[model samples]
Target: MTLRHAAFAAAAAMLLMGPAHAAELEKLWEIDGLKQPESALYDASGGVIFVSEVVGDMRAKDGDGQISKVSPEGKVVQSGWVKGLNAPKGLGLSGGKLYAADIDELVEIDVASGKVTARHKVEGAVFLNDIVTDGAGRVYVSDSGTNTISVLESGEVKPWLRNDRLNSPNGLAIEGDAMVVASFGKPAAAGQEAVPGFLVEAPLSGDSVRTLGDGSPIGALDGLVVLGGGKYLATDYIKGGLLRIDQSGSFETLAPLPSGTADLSYDPQTKTAFVPQNKEGKLTAFRIP
Candidate 1:
């Protein structure tokens, strides 16, 4: 049965370590009306949250996709659907514009117009995953297929950086001039479902695209968000837990999510972390202290 309303999906209280706040993390809403919820972000104006539904099937990846908005009152609604998309993931909203990363492309939705305003086909994007936007209007996208990250310049694809040190870079965030990345150190491919996660840092400079070799410790890092005061929260898919990383490169587990947490983002103004469960088709909301 479809849940009439979305509620908190919380597990048992956890014994946190290393000065971490143990505020209860709960499942805010379960997306029944969609298929394969992969990534989530907030709509600043309407007090709603948008989640990407990636349709993957038995023999092939269906790739027909959509975005659902959950209102402040815990109601789920279909906000927009992108045509010719292949599995949308990693989402961001800036200046009232919503940008999403699908399996092979990037889509921009004009919330005011309620139409697909722009679409960029990522060149050689095997798994276009997470995206982050600098408030100044610069957008960064992660392409896990080629172990690379790209940026959109004037609506055209530009090679940001490609490094073999990073593999399956799924989630992205911007901290000052540094590009914070969370990824599993393996190429995201069929038949290899077992790989631990890695959280690494790289300066945003395209020429100096070198891994810092130091970042938040994670397990199959899937999604990531940056919080106020230089802290990070990530979805660890391999260990099935949420990880908290501090500025000093120190980290610990916050809470254990279900088997399939695909993406996450934070609203610094509200201090709330938005989490998406891809396989279970659920969305979780957490208050990180």
Candidate 2:
């Protein structure tokens, strides 16, 4: 056989194997002794990582939450880089500012000064979980309690989308003109058990929100990161694992983590993923294929 033919055959074999057998997470390092770290954000230009720590209860307005700064090498640069927050969960960076989902408000901090400049209140927000920013610098946050996604733009915070179909959205990611949501699934109703969550795609310009694939349950999903080529990496908050979900909504567990694997951050350029193990009080870094 010709060399080109052999290469094509090998590639076809890998495609047939699917992501389930092809993807594996290699552990790089872990930083322990965190205070219920819930989310991580990697700043490529700044060469650092930011972690939100819920020092106390997850739902309490105790004002003990803090953000930590860590080096790429797993060293804690500053344990309390920013404080005076009430259970901050998600972190996003844009326009030299850092935005965090703090319970019911969007907290904005100057990345250079590490000072919180503003806190935009979401009127009906119950438990704000994840935050993401688009290329235009507009910020979007998910309220898991209210099943809503709110947006902050032009100096105003308002509800962008609210629907029961969100099913307790916990993570947010921007993909072109659509927003990919990691649902935590709806809480159990009377005489009914809780339902496992699934990936949802909501159009940014329309009201159509639909399940990604066949409406099948994946897990109580949390963090969501777009890996391009119609692929995503998500963390299951309840099941405690990393998942590789395709555009068709089919998924395979990539890593079996501990419970409370909350909002994770992926640096595509470096091919690294940072996971905040909320229950274990640790931040782990893994090299991804």
Candidate 3:
């Protein structure tokens, strides 16, 4: 079946398997006119939001991608805070710098000056999607194209793990000594079709990757955030919704969203979620109660 038909089937299946309790999302505000906004990062210290826009093709190196600065009150502070990127997706903040996964490179920007301080290329990387940073200032990037996870430390980038079992990892989140990965599932092959992904845990110090729970397929997970108490909030890129997942691998759909919802950012203090609607060219803020 085509991707569109698959999406519809997924949505219908979700409705059939009703959630135990559907969490209501109060729409706080929305900022429109964005260009394929793929990821959002909440800067608590700066009291603002950073959005990465893939203005052109997702894999093109046309240098039209950029990061925009938005205010907490839903105002566009800077349309092109940091420009000249190549299909930038995920956004991470560490050591007073903003890191963006630009295709095969990690573009670093000084938070204060909004200047491109460095661009660390990932050798042989296909599509670098999501990024996360640990408390120790280590940045981890997930490459969806290569089913690999790479790390940046001491001003260098290197492949940390390359596991086929990762199922084309898309989002990365550091949880204590392990990194929780949101896989995009395997790519569509000649005789096989694409399937829904699941969550996995990879120890930071070892190569052993453990699949959470029974490894039941969730949707094509994109953005992932720790909701504390062994729970997580993830966005389903294919099914088009937000999911609340437990450590045991069971999950419930929280909210149905637009089809192209990409990476999600949450503000824990305010209990607000920022979702980037890539095809809609908008960033929506919702209060999760």
> What's the TM-score of every candidate structure?
0.81, 0.91, 0.90
Candidate models: Cα lDDT each: 0.72, 0.92, 0.91
RMSD of each: 10.8, 4.1, 10.3
Better of 1 and 3 by TM-score: 3
Candidate 1 residue-wise lDDT, 1-289, digit = tens? 2343322222122322234645665545444545777887776666777777777741134646777777643567655445445677888776667888876677888877657788888888777888898867777899877888988867778779888666678788887888888876653468765556566778878555445346433577888888757678888765567788766667777777777777876677767777777767667676776
Off by over 4 Å in 2: 1-23, 188-191
Tens digit per residue, CA lDDT, model 3, 103-166: 9999999999999999999999999999999888888999999888999999999999999889
Candidate number with greatest TM-score: 2
C-alpha lDDT (0 to 100) for residue 148 of candidate 3? 88
lDDT score for residue 203 of model 2 = 95
Tens-digit lDDT string for candidate 2 (157-257) = 98999998999999899999899999999666899987999989899974879888888999999999999999999999887998889988899887899
Best by lDDT: 2
Q: Which ten residues in a row have the lowest lDDT in candidate 3?
A: 18-27
